[model samples]
Target: MTNFFDQFMSPTYLGVPLMALALTLPWVLYPTPSSRWLNNRLLTLQAWFINRFTQQLLLPLNTGGHKWAVMFTSLMLFLLTINLMGLLPYTFTPTTQLSLNMGLAVPLWLATVIIGMRNQPTIALGHLLPEGTPPLLVPILIIIETISLFIRPLALGVRLTANLTAGHLLIQLIATAVFVLMSTMPTVAIITATVLFLLTLLEVAVAMIQAYVFVLLLSLYLQENV
Candidate 1:
């Protein structure tokens, strides 16, 4: 029903317009930097994760690109938190909105392209055409490559929006089926509920993976530019 899709819509709270609280909640929840020889398990675990992720993400990039390490890592954390939080009852996922996703994608994608053009114009332009191309196909290839280059941010935005929207719809449908069948077919309802539980677990994994992928692709873009 239309009501199922309505859950994804943004809701206003009181008189103030609020987007996903999950966007800011993670930062508030994070512990402040402390000065000590030893730290708690949670802080240690968080540190290990950030350090490991940063190392792997930056490994392929030149030293020039390392400057963005903090920004990208923060983006990854913000996305991961927003996505995971959306799985909770009564929460909205901002990433499910194409506009929000595009807003994130376009600026960052454009920045990379700009950097490439500014710092290495020849290399950036070189990406448009292959080393050896037939004269007859030159215009066609250039047009194709240009279109593809422009589509990167669009692809990024749509990919995130589609995946999250699909997963949420599936979860809602399954949950509704379980609820509707509970009295008529108890056993079937139980099975459906079990499947819903499993799907929730899968959705959790998808949330994390998608967030990682989003950031990973951005890093690759940066790698090309820097």
Candidate 2:
């Protein structure tokens, strides 16, 4: 297990799963659906829809089809992959690393803010200021808003990092205890092992749930701000 940890922690390989996950999840969830019309005419319905409504006719891709579904599922799948990857014996959970979690959270936060500002330029700053702010309070309000804007990404990063770090450490400690106890007596060891097994299962579920929750929050932020 120690050897396994060393191998898993190797820098060259540590990020491969994250990269593969980013690409593979998007592909798997948004795989191209087959159609006779597309094969015969070389014009996929999806492509045609985009060409007609989005580019030519000036419309948004809000038909609530593969585009939206794929966006959501992709986020969830990537997070889940990262979360579960940690559960594999000896693997260092990427989410437990603040830098990795920050990498994800920062981009999402920026995207939400940038998209909102771009789409609603006039209202974006005002949204932060609120209507009741007094004339003298405008400068203070601006400072507060700026801080809040920055805090969003920081908060997201810390939240995931804290959760993963604490959970992984707890599991490791429990497993260690069970192993030592098992050496002392077979019967007690068996019971301890059973508890460890249950904790492992619970840990897996928590990891997945945390990933889902992270993505869900990002989606909500996008929906609200964008």
Instruction: List candidate 1 stretches off by more than 4 Å.
Output: none
lDDT comparing candidate 1 with the true structure: 0.91
Please, what is the whole-model Cα lDDT of each candidate in the order they appear?
0.91, 0.66
Candidate 2: which pairs clash?
A: none
Pairs that clash in candidate 1: none
Per-residue lDDT of candidate 2, residues 2-33 (tens digit): 53233324244554545444334434543365
Off by over 4 Å in 2: 1-8, 11-69, 90-92, 134-138, 185-188
lDDT score for residue 135 of model 2: 97
Error of 1 at 4 (Å): 1.4
Each candidate's number of clashing pairs is 0, 0
